[model samples]
Target: MRRFNLKLYLIFILVLLVRISNAHQETIRVGFIESPPLIYNKDEKLVGALVDYLNDILPNFNIKFVKTPLSRVPDLLDKDVIQIFPMYFYSAERADKVHYIPTSFHALNPCLCALKENKIPSTIRDPKSFEQKTIVHLRGTLKNRDFLNFKNTNYLELPTQDYYEKSLKMLKLKRAEYAYFADFQQVKRFLNNKKHSNIHCENSHYPKDEMFFVTNKNFYLKKNLELKISKTSFKTYLKKHLSRVNWQVD
Candidate 1:
């Protein structure tokens, strides 16, 4: 009886040791860009809706954040360097690389943006009317890809710019006749310039599409753990900032 009791005590101590070892482990890492209001970097610190959300809900989990270009979110997630990024459109090529989180939005309402001076057709209502307008677009963005293959348009397509807002400014400044934009909040921020630049969203625009997170197929194999973190963290993010006016698209 004494021998049996000693064995049980050893097993309990071993179990406790394992648990402690796991507890000391570091948290999973994540990445994002400096898109203001959505994701922003201030004084070398990252703060925004996404960051704030993680701060509130991911405390229980171990996480490290890496700041990078928005263009890299899908690659990082695929590499498993970070856990999530917000406000991205779904594509077949991306689908081949990672699993996407189901969300309310896929693509944003994109429109034809033009300098106040461009002569837009009264008949212009869709992509078809962009026949002769010199346009600025971004690489890897839906707008760029959608317009690149155009055999119909007679105008020139400008090189992809670093920022979408900057591209719009380029269009307004006569660098191009038009530049299309999708993210409303970002667009609003760009247009708020006191210069009161003459740019307008066409009365006829494309329908809004879906945007959501793509799981890094390579990095995240623990579905249960990721799902747990994703659910709570995203909810906390929305709960805290969703009510703020800055988040609205209209």
Candidate 2:
């Protein structure tokens, strides 16, 4: 009688565990930002290229999401608070620690912005241009390697509290010689607006950079799911998202 009860108790525990797992079904959350035309914020809601992309593809993983500032992502992610990010450039150190699901490197066209009258050479042309220009950018991101060699690049890094809006203000007040950003319509909006005639994009950004996601590669649940989505499925998922975001791709 006692033996029979023990067997039944074990079965009960097994069933209970399974039930708990299914009930929780925690989703692998990813972090993204509000970069208009890429990731935009509206009404305390996030919507844009990255958001749309994830909305379509994330379902495949049975994961949930949380939109957050790019800087905050690392802290949450280091402890596996969240396991994903919409788009990130792969790095050797990150690759060793995080799993980069195969995806397009060149995800979008790039653009550079600066004051119109500030003839500092469109390209930065070379790193030396930084010495003559003040560069403002979203913190916690790698600046373009093209300008890395230049040590004299005067720079102003802002927190998310006042990123783009502050940048616009700086440019308008001629406080910054240049601000680096990549977006089609938003850059156009800034350039076309009468208030921003002094600031404009370079001829255009060249050697367009690529963007993709980074998964901790350490979380077992997310790892298995990410792997289950084959390369073909991943690419197809990405394409569908691109279409949804109205990004032009050949």
Best by TM-score: 2
For every candidate in turn, the CA RMSD to the true structure comes to 8.5, 8.8
How far off is model 1, as Cα RMSD? 8.5
Model 2 regions lying over 4 Å from their true place: 1-25, 60-64, 67-75, 193-195, 203-205, 220-250
Worst 10 residues of 1 by lDDT: 241-250
TM-score, one value per model: 0.66, 0.69
- For 1-250, candidate 1 gives per-residue lDDT tens digits of 9999999999999999988977986686766544545565455665667776655544566657776455676677766677666556777777777666654322455656676677554443356756655666544455434554556664443333345556766775686776656555456545664344677656243556565755566544345434645456454454454344242222
Best by the lDDT measure = 2
lDDT against the true structure, per candidate, is: 0.58, 0.59
Candidate 2 TM-score, C-alpha based: 0.69
Task: Give me the displacement of residue 94 in model 1, in angstroms.
Answer: 1.2
Tens-place lDDT per residue, model 2, 1-250, is 9999999999999999988876776566767665554555555555554555555555444455566666565566777767887566656655665667675433544555666676646564577656766777667554545664477767777765546567667877888877656544445654454356666676353555567666665656454435443332334433443333322111
Candidate 2 at residue 216, lDDT?
67
